[model samples]
Target: MINFTLDQWYGWINAFLWPFARLLAMFSVAPVFGESTAPSIPKVGLAAVIAMVVAPTLPPFPALATSSYEGLLVLAQQVFIGMALGFVIRICFSAVQTAGDFVGLQMGLSLATLYDPSTHSNTEVLARLFNILAMLVFLVFNGHLLMLDVLIRSFTALPIGHASLNPAAWMGLAELGGKIFSSGLLLALPLIAALLTLNISLGILNRAAPQLSAFSVGFPIMLISGVLLLTVVLPHTPSYLNEFYQEMLGHMARIADTFAAPRGGAN
Candidate 1:
């Protein structure tokens, strides 16, 4: 029978535990992997499997007792880093959903919402539809694999440590939140402009002849027009989403670099 010293056992545990913590935290929030309908067992199992694969490759990390204060801090840092990375990617999806919200509102479909199990909230039909399409695109493009690649690279970019993260890194993350509106607005602008023009034309017609009942016909017109526009727009989305994912991947790299830099130092 093989025997191991206490230190050897601790080394083995440390090798797996830290990486597992980070992967588990990431999978808890990252898109596709984080879906609520997915059972937690698989997420945990996947995290474990990845940690095992990654542990041997990790650079030598500080060996501290798991119960030690510094060890706890390191664990927390891993969790925070993982969550930040996941949140940045999640923002990409949020932008797409926001664009759908804009188009749905313009098409008078804002009220047509359904219970979204993934989000655990009532979501507009168009918004949900867009999210589904985006998910499909993400899968088709192997985005999930890319995301995992980024996560693995982050370990090298921001190694396991007790280093105090720069405040600027957190600030940068907060600022990144603005992408939801800016990107969303851009994506939805074409549809919004078309629908707005339709609404304006209907309003002018109603003013010219009240008997035309433009108000009565406007809903159907907007709905049908919106559907037609989506058919045109949907085909073009993969390219935009590809660019969007690339941009977020850049952000993830920056974040990891920033977090690894010493506090108050240039990253």
Candidate 2:
């Protein structure tokens, strides 16, 4: 004999559906988990599994029919929250790629690009290389686990169906977006300065010895120097990436708090 009332069914559904919506939205944008080449079925399944695990811990859902306007609005809020959080982490990878682009341009490898399935666009060769390294660094530091933990904590900070997201949160996200350039430039600065000095020296040599072809001599020298510099630079990069991930995790928490706070209130 099986007896299940409609209210009980709604309770079960509410416990799972909203959380599932948020998790699915997050996986749609998060790095590695969200890669375009990855099959969609796994993402959906993983979201479902996580939603099942998280549902029991969630606070009771507000009294609203799933098909009602208010319920839909809440659902949209959850999706937005998930996507925004995932995007915040995605920015970390973008910063690394940006640094690579700067270095590659300096090294005359700007034209050497490949199709990046994750972005669905062509990216500079060095950018792709840096992205791969960043992915590895992220895994080494258990960033994926941290990301999941943040998502879980977000329920406590933002909750389900408390839908008034602060405008300042969006503003903050926009501001954080600007870090792609600033952080990237900082990362590439040492190499950029060295390469600029090398180019200057090459220019002076060319001026003093007009017989030496700049194209033949300067190009090879620059290429070799860039390779050597990159080898030296990369060993130090994991440390920088570790710090960057820690900072980004802090930002994620702050953003969740911002998302939960009342408009114009201190977060």
Please tell me which predicted candidate would have the highest TM-score against the true structure.
Answer: 1
The residue ranges of model 2 lying beyond 4 angstroms of the native Cα positions read: none
- Maximum-lDDT candidate: 1
lDDT of 2: 0.89
Candidate 1, residues 40-70: lDDT per residue as tens digits? 9999999999999998998888878876898
lDDT of each: 0.90, 0.89
Using all chains and alpha carbons, the TM-scores for the candidates as numbered come to: 0.97, 0.96
